[model samples]
Target: MLPKGFFHRRVVLTAGLVLGLTGSAFGAAAGNTATNKAPSSTSPVGSTNVTVADPTVPRPPGTPCTVQLFSGVAFNDFNPRPYAYAPPAGCGTRWSKVVLEADFSVTAGRQFDRTATLWLGGVNLYFGTTEEPSSTVAPSWHVERDLTDYSALLRQAGNGQALIGNVVNSTYTGVIYGSARLLFYPASILAPAAHAPDAVVPLGSDPVGNTVSLATPSSQLSKSLSLPTNVERAYLDVFVQSQNADEFWYTCVPDQYAAEVQECGGGNFREAEISIDGQPAGVAPVYPWIYSGGIDPYLWRPTTGVQTLNFMPYRVDLTPFAGVLSNGAAHQVAVNVAGANNYFSATASLLLYLDPHAKTVTGQIERNTLVGQPPTPTIGDTLTTDSSGNITGAITTQLSRHFIIAGYANTSHGRVDSTVDQTVGFGDIQTFTINATTYRQVTDQQTSSDGVSQSTVGGFVTGKYSEHMRYPLHLDVNQVTAADGSFTLATVAHQGDEKNLAHQLFGITLYSAKLSNTVDSDDTLAFDASGNLTSHSNQQSTQTFAFNDSLGGCYRTDVGSFSGAVSSYATGTGCPGQQNRLFWFTHPDGSPENGNAVLGW
Candidate 1:
């Protein structure tokens, strides 16, 4: 299951993927952070920044359907047990946006350290502390993960099967509980021109499974899939995870781009670089996964965890490359682990949206043309460390660099052009400890800017975009445990007033008018050695825009406000809505898990 939106990543290359990219990687990048910064020479800024839509596309009508396409099964063992989901009743082909959702919960007092996963077709949806989220103590918990990108597999065409399993925990007191489903939002809500891939081709291995660890260098894997004919749009959807690789990437790479106050050493900030037949395609950022930390809760999880649970995958809109790849030939699509480490692991798929009328599609790879890339990043000198290998030191990345990638897809539909600019102008400094109870202080000031432009056969059927984010991040996470086994996971994450302003020019109206949303969240989660919990959190987000319902859009200039105050360790329903959704974003930029998407990658 692959995902996509216009302005193409919102500009992401995240934990190692490209932009919820306008969302985190540089998978997706961090979008909500820099909401108010000035646009760059390559960035799209302001309301007057009109978006042109395809004239021939149908005007959306009626309320979209939110269907439950699948119901997942539960698992408690790592025996590769399987779960299943069937689409909502009345499901049909008219669907446009589809998202996979999973709800999994585990109570405290369990000694489990394994991941829970659901696999459909080639797409994988992970639960628990798997993939990358640290599997530490928390309350009996339930979480909903989004998998809209893989809507292709949630089809009524057949019954979908998902495999569920977790690494065994000897203390085993709590059962691993969960289910999976898909939420479908009809195409009628979007312009008839809304795009959905006609074919989703799995390009790599792991249909069975593969481990991304030291056994595999850089966690690199490659495969080639045949392309469909008349392809007008395409996307490279990727999933990857690594345990114990978090600190290496987060602290080592410094910033995906060179920083100002400090400079990064070590070539660790390597992204998931892809190539088509040896030609460079795109880059996916390597995330400093929460699972990459030490022996904790997530050790048993898959890829640390999936994005819906804060873990994520990288996606590259192959649409720009659509023109050059529509030959319906067997093409070479490869994922590169340029990070030079075996901790990063990955699996990839290429999704294509067809244009039946398109007689041909072709394009070229031009790296550093629009969105420049950072040079090889280096890690700073290792600092003094404790007996447990917890290094107590500071990092100063002294390089300021920029990465640009630009190209166009030529097809019967005209040119699908794109230019992305990801700049790392400041320093990304971090201090961390890898003991049982971890600690980190990160002060990062950087910018990730992105834009995409397109036109159809008539040229009037056009698309334009601009999104520039200057996110300056300052956060600290201290998950400390006392000798008595009492522990607290305190996190204070702050995003300066910044805006990732993105406008998709489609026809005369603008939809999803999310703009300049300032963000800041603080929380302190505490638990007994047995994992009972009380969490106190305060979060604020303001998404301001001027469009409204009358415009047949949802981006009315407004704000979303929410807060929480809790100090007691309550179970089940006691904590209400105390969970911190720190990575939430809006508009062109989709969150790591869900959003309104115009282009389905």
Candidate 2:
């Protein structure tokens, strides 16, 4: 089954496919390490300080009924993938000069968040990296020399390093079209070490795709270029791996803007090149490399085993597979990959389900396994998990049919019994329209297990308070009593007083059983300036927020805590309902996020 966040991505990418390109192309003329700085400019290209929602549409939501399980893909720092553009022939000729203003944003828990701005004339002019944390630095564009003359050779710098004519309007807006060459910097240029400081050592390989290695190992003192037959792109940029061992280092091109490069004297040295060895492995003719104001700390090429050039392609594979299915609602998808270690065949399946309107799940799943990772054992050294004998349950709101809650239970007595994983306890905030009042019902459950056998049952209830519900409501009363059995309760009213917290003075006795006479919990909620719910008051909490994305139905949540940082991951972009998922299309677009969601029994 396709994991949960795929469909929405397809939509966003599909939109990005316009004219086979994104914004404009940029270049780094030369940078100095002694006084590392971007080309001096007048006003900011576009305000790096502005906070605007992305213009791209949101993805689709995941189907609530689909069986959702954890997939192995991890979400870390976000970066823009390579893209190219071939603007209409007349678009560039229509305007003497052009400026590009683009905005990009992703949720905190997404895989990558990257954006770049570039200026171009006859050729790709230089700009800078944008949309990143401020501490990091990278190459940027400035008005060192005015736009003098436009020529063909300079515009088509032949081997990837093209020189634009001259600056015209310094600034312009609305889509500018041209034949842009989105160059993919050598893996070395996009390497993590290139951005590392003198004292530090790089931990791993480059995040970006290309690589540049010296044909023959040379010394930092050698200004003469030591040709590496392995240079992949015409411009295979490199950086000093370590400064702690030596004084300083340099490259063939100027390093005025490569802040990571160290200066020996007033100038940085470059190792000259002779004859190249390896052919361009995979270089895209016109690929897009995004840049935000500050350097993207996490942005880098995908590491490969060989130190070879892998440039962007003139035309990437953007076709979709025939096996992919799309429905209007959320669907859980699973992609089954069948192949040996090296090659594989894949097929995807879709499972659709709706979110429950309301209901709390409370029960100790004894001798069973809860869908994903087993719960941590607080006092014990080992917590075993059972992977066989499936158990599933659902939670639905009494009023609305739009939402639902589902759970997978694994029993200890399976065909191949391993260990038992039992649900300790769980609760839910049930939202439904009762009569005219909007009420939130609280329910909870708990369970214990000993690998071989286990059992548990828990429930809770709360009092009905107000008729009209605000956008961000405060924490209402909710608890589970388990002396002999378990049941939940919430504050319907104050013991005998009609006026308690809100000040409607009508005092009754403290004997009303339905009205919370004893305060079991004192929790609350916090909202943002936009009335959007931000945090909760409860000491222990697990809240989920659902939203839409380009892929279709998508969601994010804070599993626990107020002070602890919230982490979110997504699943289901293709085949829904299946346990395993594979990429049906390296580039999938248009399908709703729900269509790619997956559900497993």
Candidate 3:
């Protein structure tokens, strides 16, 4: 099990160490650092809060050349900070490995968590939310991502922007600052350059990179592109961030009970839909990510929710449509959220792998059974109201879908046929009891996806990929008021994320892995009769992360905290033999593993 504050403290110390060792060299290399202005005299104190995630990105055995993207950029308003980017100098354009690293800090004071995004050439590189600050606690953290697949876009010079929409006033007084850089490892005899997408196409309303806002199901974010004709494989990475009334969608109710239950409408099912020239291509499940300030802020003081600091985009296999896309005509690729309520922010990018030996490839979509729209959810409710205006009842919602897409392309090697079979499911159940002096709500929700992609040449399988993912969440809230108007609020939450993946090339197992992370927390807040804040207690939280792959890479850690400080920390508890285990036996060619797949469709 993971402790609430252990991960946060560990990340803080690690970030400080990195800064201490390379601050001077990085500053000297960055000739023109972006900056709004120097911070005020009352600089924010570095925070100890951190997100629960893998602290390291497996690397090759070689030195890396660093390139500074931006440094110490301040964000206090709605404007975006623009920066210029160029390829690294010493490292050649083709690198064996590329990584993106960033550091962020917020001033100590009262402030709500804000959203942050980085975009280059109209493609989103990063999307996440900042940590909330308190009068005594200021938070700082570091994040890293493997950008080796996006090499095609990073090979050229471009202009990008970093947007951290924030509000700083007499009430909300916290300001956010950020610095980011890229590391490129040169290819050598031991570490050869890996295969990467030949072209990357951004899908959004603007060409210079920006997130599109979708207020309803009818709204769409689409892009038209004339892609290369030799495309052999294709995939799209998609992101959908819930905002406003949609933030707590899991606890929502049917439209008929919106007023009675006091919850959001449109049911509790949401998904991202992909389309190729108005034809259904694939589906991506929406993960429920809670921000630092969500619900009761005290619950996340030291530890944050899963992917709260840095989000992982869902990859949708579009290889079946590669034949249709390679026709050399301008095709419209679009993304939209199903069952959207109020609004949502969305972004996506198209990745294509070209047939190096073939100048032009031709084929057509043989079969596509996926419907353009998702099925309507089924909702059930049973409630009874008494004479005293007290209400008690339960509500449930469920939705599921299954589809298969198949196509063939005549490439330089041979006539390659590809098929994608997938299934998605979602369910939410909520129980409520409300009265004049008491209010209670409990929610249990789950979202899952299972899929298999296979490629064949002349009826013989060439590659096969399989992935299974599940997200489970539970939340309970109880509030009681005394006759004198004094009140107490108690909350408990349990969240988990699990994924298993495997890749096989010509019947040879190249990669396989399993990952699981979970967090459990509970707290209580007391208020005076006059409604002024009084005290909080019983604040406790714990987290655990376990990961293992066929490549001999294994990591496991558990930690717990109480009253906002770490209580215990342990490692290797979930590994073989119960011995602390953390190591990486990566392939010399930089093959994908764990979070990434070698045969990504």
Candidate 4:
């Protein structure tokens, strides 16, 4: 049964359809060591296909003790699979690093893309979506994440669940199976464990079903906790995923024009807002994530959208509120999607660091200028209709916000002041041309968040951190019905995720990095008058990823495919000296470097 507001495009003459970090440095250098690997090729009609991606996580030099969280667990129903988790004993608790790895596969058959999530101790370890399977292409893939920051939670034994909601019946026959494990790297004389969060707090629903559904701006996923009194720093890692009608939020129009353009409403703007005890704390810009079965599936054959298989959570610094949260009373932390329609799935975790020397501390919020809600967007609609009922015009929506949050905490060392200044901006423009013979829609959208945080003691700056991120998307869909009733559907899409981050201490830059990933694709589908698909052609896609850090670590890869087969591959083209290489070393102060490096991307 389709849920309310669910939008799935189906054409009857229907022939069948369609469908669609980090670690370690042990010697991080910045050059390409080898050629880029080719992407997996599409399998024949009754076989399995291997979907591939370039490796993004850097590994430390030490050997790791592995702990199996779950093995060959099948997900053929809505019930989440439960599992037991215990830290690896041999590796010791104070390890240099921790990593999570998982593998998933689906039987070759028919199935829609499903959401996948893993939770341990009520905290989200992974969140992503599966690939759609076809009669000829059963797909398999692997994903990994660095969990060093959540080491506090991993140190204790716990129970968790893996959720990959699916249905298996005579129809929708695909079955998904998965396995996951954690790798613990023990600290050594040369490579010691980095400073990790002292406490971890989860802001989610009940256990197992660890995510909350927010149907509107007023809906929130909140948790009340009695935190430690000496809290010195705090951060929240948040994830907001669009579901049901909100999946294609960037393509939606204002409510009044929904029926006119055959699109969803609520405008094309969504942002994740965070609050502390009813007061605004911070904002996280939403990324326009496209799933495997979104739009024209053919466009994502050999390469998928950026972060489609593995999502990177956005981190919101809540350090300024540390004093208020440590006042000995239970405080509430909440999250919501500002423009959620139908709904959005949300989850978050709070990380806190306490002053080791002080058993108790005090502080207060000095100033808070962040509003609870974003300003109303400027909506411009120039759509026009002729006497024949044909529609032609453009609709544009844009919004921008800027604010500052400040607070101070008294610790054993001294009184420290923390302030955060941020700016968020969003813009979406869509143009439509509709008539009896043609249906065309084009959309261009961009979202960005830029912020900086600084810590000072006695009026002297002690630390500084800055981050900048941007998401850009462009899509064009055109369909034309010929006089004989036959029709052609063509689509062109370009999507990107880009980010830059840096940290400084005592006026010296300690760490800095830059990352960019993009995908571009186009395809055409033809159907006969009987509504039967005749052919699909002009299928092409490409993905490029580039990353560099001040420590001298560098990685870059480009993969291209045509007609469902990988055709070209390259590496290190965008790195320093056009070479791909990675080597990292941590400084005594816990700052990381790829090599003896300067502070720049």
**Which is better, 2 or 3, measured by TM-score?**
3
Error of 2 at 29 (Å): 18
Question: Cα miss at 360, model 3 (Å)?
Answer: 1.4
Query: Sort by lDDT, best first: what order?
Result: 4, 3, 1, 2
Better of 1 and 3 by TM-score: 3
- For residues 89-115, what per-residue lDDT tens digits would candidate 2 score against the true structure? 322221121222122221221111121
Judged by TM-score relative to the true structure, which candidate is superior, 1 or 2? Answer: 1
CA lDDT of every candidate: 0.41, 0.18, 0.73, 0.75
Candidate 4: stretches off by over 4 Å = 1-54, 372-375, 574-579, 584-601
Model 2 stretches astray by more than 4 angstroms: 1-95, 98-102, 109-601
Query: Best by TM-score, which number?
Result: 4
Q: What's the lDDT for residue 547 in model 3?
A: 80
**Per-model RMSD to reference:** 13.3, 31.4, 8.8, 7.1
Worst 10 residues of 2 by lDDT: 301-310
**For model 3, where is the 10-residue window of minimal lDDT?**
26-35
Give the TM-score of each candidate.
0.61, 0.17, 0.88, 0.90
Weakest 10 consecutive residues of candidate 1 by summed lDDT: 49-58
